[model samples]
Target chain A: MFIEFKDVSFKYPNNDKNVIDHLSFTLEKGSMLAILGHNGSGKSTIAKLIMGLLKATSGSIYICDTLLDEKSIDDLRQKMSIIFQNPDNQFVGVTVKDDIAFGLENHQIPRQEMLEKISKYATLVDMMAFLDANPENLSGGQKQRVAIAGALAMETELIIFDEATSMLDPKGTKEINAMIKKLKNEHNKTIITITHNLEEALFADRVMVINDGKIVLDGSPQEVLKEQTILEASGLKLIDGIAIIKEIEKTSLLSKENKEKICEALWELTFKM
Target chain B: MGINFQNVDFKYAKKASHKQLDNVSLNIDEKDEFIAIVGHTGSGKSTLVQHMNALLFANSGNITIFDTKVVRNKKIKLKPIRKHVGLVFQFPEYQVFETTVLDDIMFGPKNFGKTTDLAKELAIKASQLVGLDEELLTRSPFTLSGGQMRKVAIAGALAIDPDILILDEPTVGLDPKGKIELMELLLAMQNKTHKSIIIISHDMNIVAKYTKRIMVMHSGKLVFDGSKEALFNNEALLKEYNLDLPTAAYLAKELKAMHLIDYDSLPLTKEELTHIILGDSCNE
Candidate 1:
């Protein structure tokens, strides 16, 4: 397992409620997993725990089968990177090139290797042209591209995107999704995408629905997204394609097999339906 | 009874070469209007709506809201214009500061010089309009859920009793259900009050299903202004503006390819697409 969490339960110091309650899951290496939940459902807490920004009040978390603790935190953090919802908040350097190189500078990488990594990652995210441009002047999509370049330049084994596309327009979202798919398919990057958007979850290898800090549903998106009742209870709705299938399932004309055909047909459509 | 902008040009700085609103001309009726302004980021959608309430004055040309002239040099009190044009920014929840939901909703009305009793009444009415209950009104706004906090902020806007309501990406961060519920609430409010609504959004689906008129902005220029149906049918224009076709529109195109539906014009709503696909065999 690349990452594992066992019997995790956490509560804020002043609060009686456990924000995350008795959660257990393991993620395989090189697989993409999406975490879906309503606001205040402990999704962000899980991300924080993985980033070692918040210590697990109980239970254990292991990276590469090594237990996560204060002693291993610095080393573990170097193995993972996180991109937040807002790129403006994550950007640290004045220029895109400097921002991408900021992490390597922390690692004290030699100047020659740092320059090569910066060029490689910037080219990967299609931000090479704007390497010298001010990060503030870029569009939301472009800024996200710069952030992705920075994250990728870190060369971490695991990357967590916490609602990274929430602030973007649809075009911007599509651009980011394309990059994520590339990263997963071509580069074998392990990913955890935390979002409320069901459509985003459709691209994942596995999907987990979190409610009240527990995993209520976990499976392939095809299986988990069909559970309309659970999705509704968790304050989520199906994507447009799945939603249309659900509505079609209500009719007498289409059989179970035909409904499945609609799902496949809709999924195969070049454009989003 | 409407807002009119003519040859309006605005720039953040006088020395800035590019104009934010380049000769923008548009008319928005005060009654029975549901409009959506859509474009990519930095396309001047936000700048356009900010002008509706005199929040930003054009550097050149003219803007008339209802009957008052809006100009950069004008010293007239903008409170009256702002009173009739309530502008809700993205994430209106950040504006909620009152201890209780009721007090938060009443703040706008009270600031507008309504008596405490009248403000309370308006607060109750606005909360009810947004589907917020009296019980929640007494609780701390901070304690409410994200959806509820958003409602409280919207209620604050409604408490001002604006004739025209403008919201910037109102459903940006909401979940799917939350997005639909908020949009439906706005539709219900529009139905009950007949108030004009202007929404700046990138969700083509919401724009297609809810708004009657569509305004396309591109690079700080108004490119197209028309009905949603017309906008969806214009593939070339949609591509030029970097806008995606709504799902309903895509479905229509696919159905046409399959020889399932033969309508000359594309459909912009799910129901219309369903009718075409199911061949009117399913009951409405």
Candidate 2:
């Protein structure tokens, strides 16, 4: 496993609540995993814990078989970069170009090399036009793209998106999704996305549902979404394709008609009927 | 007769920037109804709603809200329009300026010249409406959790007893339960007070389920204004405007693909969608 958590429990220094409690999971190299849950489900907390933003109260995390401690932080952090839920909170530079350079600066690449990486990623996320644009002046979607470009420019082995698409419109979201997919395929980067929009999870290799600070469900997207009760209680939705199958199971139609209606509905719903 | 905008035009003249909103006209019915104005970010969605209250008066043309004319040429007393139409911004954290929760909720009512006692009374009612506990009322506004703080800010808006309450992305960053609770509270408010509720959100699922109508804004124009069913029925159109059907509607459409559903009308909720898929067996 590239990243593994062994019974990790995290509680804020003085807070009573264990934001993430005794949860353990793993992400293999070059694998895409998605965490699905409703608000306050500790989804973002888990991401923060992995990134070493918050210290765990108990247990430990291992990166590539190395126990996570203060010493390995520099190396572990290099392998990981996180995009927060709010684009505005994470922005640090005045211009889009400068923001992307923040990461290259950390890696200590020379000015020319840094500019090369920044220019490359800016075009990748379709932000070349906004490269000179002010970060605060860009629209929500544009801000998110610039943020993504900054992370990608760092060449982090693992990319964590904490509802990164939530701030974007549909077109912007689809663009980011396509970019994430391409990175996982071409660059072989491990992608972990924490999102409430369940539909986006359809493209994930696997979906894991976290509730009440625990990982209650983890499986292929199809398997997990098939369980209606668990999804409803967690406030997540099944992917569009699978959601229709479950809906058809509830009603008792005539034997021959049953097969027919299911087909008709799928066609109509999928843009054919 | 509640609000009217005739040939309203506004231009933000940056040193080199061009116009934001071209000449546009719209009329809003005051009686109990919900309105959602959606557009890509910077498409003038926020700019237009800011006009509902006296936040930004039109540079040109006639404007009216709650029988009060408001434009560059109209009466400048914005106090009444703001009181009647509360515009809840996207991020409550930016809007919350008070020290304590109680003080925050009292800000709007206090600004409206209500006595301290009346402001407190309104605060309590608004707090209950948003599911905020009385215990948290004394705590610092910044100390509360994200979900709780969001409710407190909304409670502050509700304290003024706005006949038409407008919220922009009330559920952003919230968990599913929090989103559901907020939606239910808004629905409850609309039910009891018959107050007009307008919500601007990117969540198609929420829009499909709760909203009776939608107003799609694009490039500073009102592109589509109609029922949710009509919008979902035209998935291609929604995509053209950079939108998609909700998960439920997406499912309904998929089931239709398999010849499971006959009606083309898009149902908002999963319950309604289940019946549509079951066809005659919907009740069962």
Candidate 3:
């Protein structure tokens, strides 16, 4: 496994209860995985654990077959890049271009080559027009684009989005979602997304539903979201495709089997629409 | 008028600025209605909402909240105007500065000149509105769960007893249950106080299901304003704004196109869609 969570359990420092408990999962290389759950479900906790921001209390996590430890921590981060929820919190540079170059600078890439990478990423996220803009001047979504450009420049093998879309508007939300899909499809990089917008997960190859510090459901959106009762119990509802399924199921015009096929076809229809 | 924006344009204080609000005009009725202002990032949605309470003044044009225009008006006091309009910034937990939950929530009321006794009463009531257990009143706000802390901050806004409440991305970063509970509490508050509520959000599905009046912004322009149905019907407008129609609204349109459902009616929720699909004759 490129990344594996082996029955890992974790608690924030000094906290008695584990935020992530008995969590075991695997991410194959180049597969975009969506992690879904409500607040306090330990989804973000799982992200922090993978990013080496928190230590696990039990079990083990392996990234690229390497055990996590202080000696390997820096190297681990070098290969894994994470985009946090708050765009402002992650910005380390003054201007968009400088910000994109921050990571490359840390990696000790020369200025000349780093400039090329920064420009490339800026264009990739459609922030080329704002390359010289101050980070604080940009809106949340614009700032996030810069953050994503910075992360993309790192070209990390595994990318995790910790509710990165929460602050963006609908168009901004779609823009970033498309970027994630592009990364997975064209770049051959593994992706992990923690989001409440289950609609965004339609294109994802796999999704894991976590709750109460444990993964409650593990499957495709078809396997999980098709069951509205299960989703609602977890404070979620069917998103795009599954929503169509539920709608068609109500009509009684289509059999349960047809409903599934139509739901499966939502992606194709959405693209054409 | 509950809120009004006229030819309002604002650029954030820094340079290399994307115009946050550009030549936008809007009018919100005095009817105690639930309104949602939704747009993608850099769409001027926040700029418009902030203008409601004078947190960010318009660079040009006028802003009127309630009956009085927000200028150097001698007739209406700005302090009282601010007290009448309470604004809750996003991730409100970060604004918690008091030692305890009760004290934090009471800060606004006390600052607005309510007695400590009255402030405490209001705090307790506000906490209940947001579904916080009273035992947490004495607990440190810093130590509470993220969801609980958000409720505490929202309760802070509630303490002022505002006539109008504007929340900027109030539901962001919350789990769905927390988001729904908060929304329900706000709805309850709206019922009890008859206060006007404005929610600034980017999520179309949320806006579709919750608000009575919908406003769409893009490129700092107020692109569309009307009912949720109208907003969804204007696919060209929604597309021009770079926003996706709410999946329900979008799917309903598709089903209508396919002759699978009613073309004129847009279903806002899954339950409604189910009713339409199953021919249950029950309105969800």
Best prediction by DockQ: 2
Ranking by TM-score: 1, 2, 3
- Going through the candidates in order, the fraction of native interface contacts each one reproduces equals 0.40, 0.58, 0.51
Candidate 2 lDDT for residue B7: 76
How are the candidates ranked when ordered by lDDT, highest leading? Answer: 1, 2, 3
| Pairs with backbone N, CA or C atoms under 3 Å apart (clashes), candidate 1 | none
Q: Could you give candidate 1's per-residue lDDT for residues A49-73 as a string of tens digits?
A: 9999999999999998889998999
Give each prediction's root-mean-square deviation over alpha carbons. 2.5, 3.1, 3.7
Candidates, DockQ: 0.47, 0.48, 0.41
Q: Which stretches of candidate 1 lie over 4 Å from their true place?
A: A253-264, A270-273, B138-140, B260-265, B280-284
lDDT string, candidate 2, B1-284, tens digits:
67788877777664425446656678777768877777677777888888888788777888899888886544467788888889888879667768889999999899999999999999999999888999999999888877888899899999999888889888876766677778988898788888888888887878877888888877777778787777777768787887766767766555556555556466767767666656655444
Worst 10 residues of 1 chain B by lDDT: B275-284
Q: Model 3: number of clashes? A: 6
Candidate 3 CAPRI level: acceptable
Task: Compute the lDDT for candidate 2.
Answer: 0.80
In Å, what is the interface RMSD of model 3? 4.3
Interface RMSD of each: 2.7, 3.7, 4.3
